[model samples]
Target: MSVYTEVGRDQLIAFLADYAVGELVHYQGISDGIENTNYFVTTDKGEFVLTLFEHHDFGELAYFLDVMTFFFEHGIPSAHPAADRQGRYLKKLCGRPAALVMRLDGRGVANVASLAQCEAIGDILGQMHIAGQQFQSRRHSQRGPEWRQETAQRLLPMMEADQAALLKNELAFQKGYADLDLPWGVTHSDLFRDNALFDGEELRGIIDFYYACDEYLLYDLAVAVNDWCVDESGTLALRHYQALMSGYLQHRQLTDAEQANWNLVLRAAALRFWLSRLQDKLFPREGEITQIKNPDAFLKILQQHRHQPFSVDELQ
Candidate 1:
């Protein structure tokens, strides 16, 4: 989360008046993500995260908060929102929608995830997908198919020839499976390594539900696998892949259709991140970023998926 909006001590203290979080001791801006402003907030009462929405409005954020609540209620290890004295989770802060969530334990492993960490991520994701079956409300991703297509088109003009060709062919291939009926539910849509926290090999919690939406459950797993189970060079790590799948299967089993489209799902997941990172690179956002993600990483991942394609069975 980028610190787009800066909150002064007085401003934060005044805002905390609505809640019972006690007097603020200190707060520091968190610059790990791109879409939102996050600060590690501490008070006499407890530690929490303060998020100022950059792209989403008050109304649009309700779904994400509700999703957080749902996950919390379902015993999922996720960041849960702290309600104000008035029992409201969504509130206003410095002219933007904001909310405070109990900060989860542990640090992000990022690109150094081990085999056991991969299995933990997969197990938790499987459990989340299963619990999502009970979710009554559904919302399509803001970054869904239409947005991806439009983004790819916009980025094509700015891409190298090889990249452009790969983008076009992948989009065409992905379009064919758009209507395929696979196991679908609430998806964490962006469960990269940084989004999940770990205390050593033990998973503490999954944070950043901002990208959570209704989509193919398998796609969610693929997104996690892409980030958590890949080597530095973007190649699949066999031991990690098998470990992840093994953990996932402990919670839920895949359908025949999901198995049939497994490799394609992996490829689709690769393209989505590649296109998004490319878009971010070309149309640079004006902000202070802790680290801007590299598009070339996803490019390499996509190329690996395409050239050395493997089935779910192979990975398992």
Candidate 2:
């Protein structure tokens, strides 16, 4: 079910020759991404990441590419999609869309163990949120209430009747408490630590913009809080949250409404990923190498958020 075509090798070589001639002699699947097929193309010029858009909307993807370009120009560390000779940010390959980008310099650290690392990520994300306001294109959140209802309906066919009911109940919980007054803007909906890269003490780049969309800005912060402040066991790591919130507030302060609504937003963020992982497990897309994330991780996150206070003092 691999979407890649060996037929494109010669054409790819021809294309790269213009931008990175005599550099890419070998290319192989890195296979790290859960959504797209990524290959690390090595050349005498340097390394680059070639990504094939898979099971994702091309229009949204194009918007994210423009977002990356804007962030990169504004001193945010990110991989801007490379334009082709015709000045196209996107290129057609083997009947699918593809893009080439400069390889980020660092590796994705599985955990943020140091306060400095957490603070650095928070600062960078704050900068991104500030800069995101400048972007004109706005995409509605993909996991909005309507999306949850539709996905639950689709998932019902694949799960036990009881499990489907449980999903419905969770969906209700989300809808009843949904916030209408939270700040809305572009967000990297998937801001897990794995999507962030670190080079020494510096945050080298944020990758994987496929999930970027217009949503509650605090939802983005909530996603980051869940990632940086939770241990593998799902317990709250208060110090990590402290450093992250401290650095984040240095750029933009959370409004009282945003703070008051933060806890449920965090729960909703947890529910969002939990439902996505469950759906992916139950009804995986064709041509996808389907592996489900640990749903318990987010469930634990939900539990931890239930008791945590969302006071200004919490922003240490």
Candidate 3:
């Protein structure tokens, strides 16, 4: 498991004292994610997920917790942050910012998602965007254009000529749309397949809101499509794309500006993942259980989006 900062039983018990979650019965490290140290925690009161922020500070962590709470209250099937006895969702455990959230009751679908699954994901994602309109605080995307440009420069030194060229070209391409006045709202910036949980075909829950921020709403949809609707060859599947778009439009219709820039936003989504993966692979952090995803997968996906931009009617 990815137990980067191990928590002793004594320390855990002390931490639980701040909350009314009863006694800590057992806990196990979750190895799936790379951003934070997570544990599937069981208590006498109920089951919850314990997280210790490895990189983010307490102030930054508060925004994510607030967003999660907002979504849960607004009927979204997202994990709700469990506030402590003091009514604070944010806490300190092992000298790191920590939180306890209700454990979702489902497993992540690691394999390719079915069309039904894609539709469900799209539907819920659109609902999330709609519900997020009421959120008060604004957090800019951490992986926005500024980060992309800086990261590209840092990774170019370690990349080959072709890889360097692709990164630079895409970065420049994204710069042109920096001020395109797209629909903005709280977006789950990293909504991949595993980030959602399902039971059979039913989407039980969506987890990991640490990457949630203020960004283009269509960009969020593009992020979901690039992962949930793409085939093994990194090409967008027509059937899956249609299903996703159909499901999304059922709840929220795209603005005319969003429609006009759909192709560009899709490319931006691909570039975001591509740049992140390359950065992670090239300059990995020291963790107990690190899984560096294949950067080339996103590279291919970006290329495909660049070459085969889709139209609105194609999705319908």
Candidate 4:
């Protein structure tokens, strides 16, 4: 849960009326994200998701919204940015920038337990990567080496002796694979199971574009592998990985060189999230629900990847 400053019912109603979308009959704060404030808004027209701009750049967010709208038109299951009375994608509310979007009808898969679930995730990710190739706008972000370096620096103070040593060694290893050639495109940046929703057994929609930026396409897949292929005990779930990779390869094929670099990508992904969580832990942002994801989870992943290597055979 995150901090959700309540917008008065009358105010929201007034907004809907001004926008001419409908009367905002009811509204409530959504408490599942760490980046921005979300609200479940229902108007006379229909139900929608209202997001308030917080920490992220508004211009970048506007670009992201456009991209998402593009995908939505092309049959990608996503929230479409709604327009106000002036036909604007963005609206000003209470001195904050806000936008309305269609609410996705599904729940998050917090614990993806089965092989079919893994395959579903893989298929969706593959589709996203393929569709993302046409998105030409560029917004830069750190993913591989630079991200690890930046995060390590931020977490250096909070980490204990052993964790610091591990981070150093991991950095060195990541640098070795930094020169590998990989396909670049717009990446979701954070596509954990929670970012996606399943309408019953089918993957319904993908949400949360705050971290969407231009980066190595495989890094996004790598993030998914690290997130979806590990068990609770920090062990590699080989069968699940196999299902996911199979589903992914069905759309976008990986080359031998790309396959070789997968290990590095996985390690980089692990360290990236680990360092981010550590930063959050050290500098807790002022919020109602500070969502400091478990950095130790990815730390355990780095340790696990060190000894028990992941291979294409493992994926199969």
> What TM-score does each of the candidates earn?
0.97, 0.89, 0.97, 0.92
lDDT of 3 by residue, 1-316 (tens): 2457888899999999989989999998888866788889999989999999888998899899889989999999999999888899988888888899999988888988988999999999989988888999999889888887888888889999988887787777788767988889999988898889999889999999999999999899999999988888899888999988888989899888888898889888888888887887778788666667887888888899888877776667
Q: Which sections of candidate 4 miss by over 4 Å?
A: 4-6, 142-144, 176-178
Q: How good is model 4 by TM-score?
A: 0.92
> Which candidate's TM-score is highest?
1
Computed on alpha carbons, the lDDT of every model, listed in order, comes to 0.87, 0.75, 0.87, 0.77
Model 4 residue 191 lDDT score: 83
Q: Candidates sorted by TM-score, descending order?
A: 1, 3, 4, 2
Q: In model 2, which range of ten residues has the least summed lDDT?
A: 1-10
Better of 3 and 4 by lDDT: 3
Candidate 4, residues 1-316, lDDT tens digits: the string is 2554456677777666656567767777776766677788887888888877776556767877887887787677877888776788887666567788888888788785568878988887788889988888888774456776876787777678987887888787887656678887888878888888887678888887767887777888888888888897667798988888888888999877777887787777777787777777787777544466776888888788887776765567
Q: Candidate 1 lDDT, tens digit per residue, 68-96?
A: 99999999999999999999998899898
Candidate 2 per-residue lDDT, tens place, 1-316, comes to: 1333332578678767546335567887653545676777777877788777765567767887887888889888998777766777777665567788888988777665578888988898898899888888988777866776787687778777765676676677678555568777888888777788888778889888878888888889989888788898777688888898888988998888887777778888877777777776666555433334676688677766655646545555
Task: Write down the worst ten-residue block by lDDT for model 4.
Answer: 1-10
- In model 2, the runs with Cα more than 4 Å from the true position are 1-8, 15-22, 156-166, 176-179, 285-291, 307-316
Candidate 1, which segments miss by more than 4 Å at Cα? none
Clashing pairs in 4: none
TM-score of 2: 0.89
